[model samples]
Target: MPQPHQADGPAQHAAGRQLPAPRTPSPRDAPPLNWGVIAPGGIAGSFVDALHTHTEQRVVAVGSRDPERARAFADRFGIPAAYGSYAEVLDDQRVDIVYIASPHSAHFAHALQAIEAGRHVLVEKAFTRNAREAERLIEAAGERGVFLMEAMWTRFLPHIDVVRQVLDSGLLGEVRTVAADHGQFMNPDAAHRLFAPELAGGALLDLGVYPVSFASMVLGPFASLTAVGEKAFTGVDGQASIVVTNESGAHGVLNTTLFARTPTTASISGTHARLEIEGDFYAPATVRLISREREVLDSYVPAQREGGLCYEAAEAARCVAAGRLESDLMPLDETLRVMRALDEIRRDLGVAYPGE
Candidate 1:
């Protein structure tokens, strides 16, 4: 297993005993690759900035429907190429991989385009509008023998690796529950993408994916789930609560909302110990391991990155260099499973995207 990156500051502990430090690699340690970014959206900007600031990976090109926007993004990021269209980016023979930063509705088409063009892809999350689309992309990538992975960057963070190590060590002892929430207040204007049906807008697909993916990470796929939600005036889900039970009887409680900001924290509790991830848990944050008796066993504070999105980019570069088709840390199967769960949640909430 890849060790976690060392913590930023000196290790802090209880009772004057230092806890173990994470051993994940620094971004500078990842193999470099030439990248082409699609959409050049907010998230893409963050990704490019993190790569430039921390990793050896280079954003060679940027593409957008608007040529001027493409050029601006490229100029801002110091990219060498700016294409007027996504097709041109895919056609760039020098581009080793394409990062699809398009909206959820366009993920399938964009990813399929990259696969057919013989380019590896790292599609931003939600993976797709639904599971069917996710499956199609996975199958296409498999047939093309090119790499494809969802940019679930959280899974690749150093603190996440530490969580994995703790879980694998059986320190948690029969994990019983996973709880997480992600919510952000958004403008309720019907024209906004977050509430626009044509864009596949909804709290479930946007803010909800984090908690859902977190639950999936802690407790595999759910065997059954029950959900309840309130819809926004614009006909999208404004808030939702979900309870999922896996085959092993482990339960996950998840909630997401666009109506208000939430604590955005997460916890995994087992018979013997529990791990608590601090607020904004999906980002670069802290984790605490505590015993059933409520004593702090250890605490992990991760080194901060500009945006922490480079971790997934680095993983993608490593996998492509190794001729691998997918990442073990965030596999295609897991992406598909999470999509299925999202689909179920939408069904229970009676929220359907256009043409779904």
Candidate 2:
């Protein structure tokens, strides 16, 4: 497997590079990465779609509580094995990694199970129902000498590398503020998993993690956070506003909601200028750099034909090949920080889940 080349700042675009020379991965390599997915759902399907776009990684097994549903997802993706129980997938000796695609409430148990079974795990965000759960899983993974990662897919996108380069290159100037919001209309039936307390239904955990993670990625962990939000009929936070002040006094305004559609956009302002991310910013989209008199920035488009989720998969494969347990860009520490922020916001709004 050929590792991806390092992507430098926004200046790479000034040279007329059309597509990023990203790492092209193939499971055909000597030490292939075999992936198993648990609780296939909307996002899991997207990850499977993205996995197809890359090489060196394959969804070897699909697992669900319902055998028929597991088989359906496996058939949909041409996966080799379908298991009726998550434990069976974990028991499969060939599975090198297990993706915890279950609802937020189940993340802790599922990820810990995979790690204990000697398989690396990728838990979807919000990594767990709360920071306490995240800590427990992180500690468990560390104790087992296995790998664990939160599937906060945005940080692995080419845009993250691009933006980091732009900021480090001194092209963005001193940081001023970061504003991000990700929300969508959710009219799920009262019984839908997203609208049920047992499933940890809420906008803060599902849609809100993106903006909060984006802000933290740019500004690092905040030193102070003051937030307020509104709950839905089910008492889950459907709307929330978080004001974060970093140690440097740099401020960030992050918002999330499930009741209605927001722009699903994000922006970063600096002492000298600002960067405008394209709508659907979470999916490795584009961003424009704007200054007083000139627009001196290049926005990134999706680099592959399939879903962009493969970027993180590619990173995981690379790290495993290198014998590393964690990723630099999307570290477990960062995952815990963002989850803690969401936890605080949920607490402020008095939105409690089943485990809490």
Q: Which one wins on lDDT?
A: 1
Give the winner by TM-score.
1
Per residue, candidate 2 scores C-alpha lDDT tens digits across 82-142 of: 9999999999988998999998988988998998898998888889998999999989989
TM-score of structure candidate 2? 0.90
lDDT of 1: 0.88
User: What are the lDDT figures for the candidates, one per model?
Assistant: 0.88, 0.80
For residues 217-247, could you state the per-residue lDDT of candidate 1 as single tens digits? 8888788999999999988889999999988
| TM-score to native of every candidate shown | 0.94, 0.90
Single out the weakest 10-residue window by summed lDDT for candidate 2.
15-24
lDDT at 323, model 2:
79
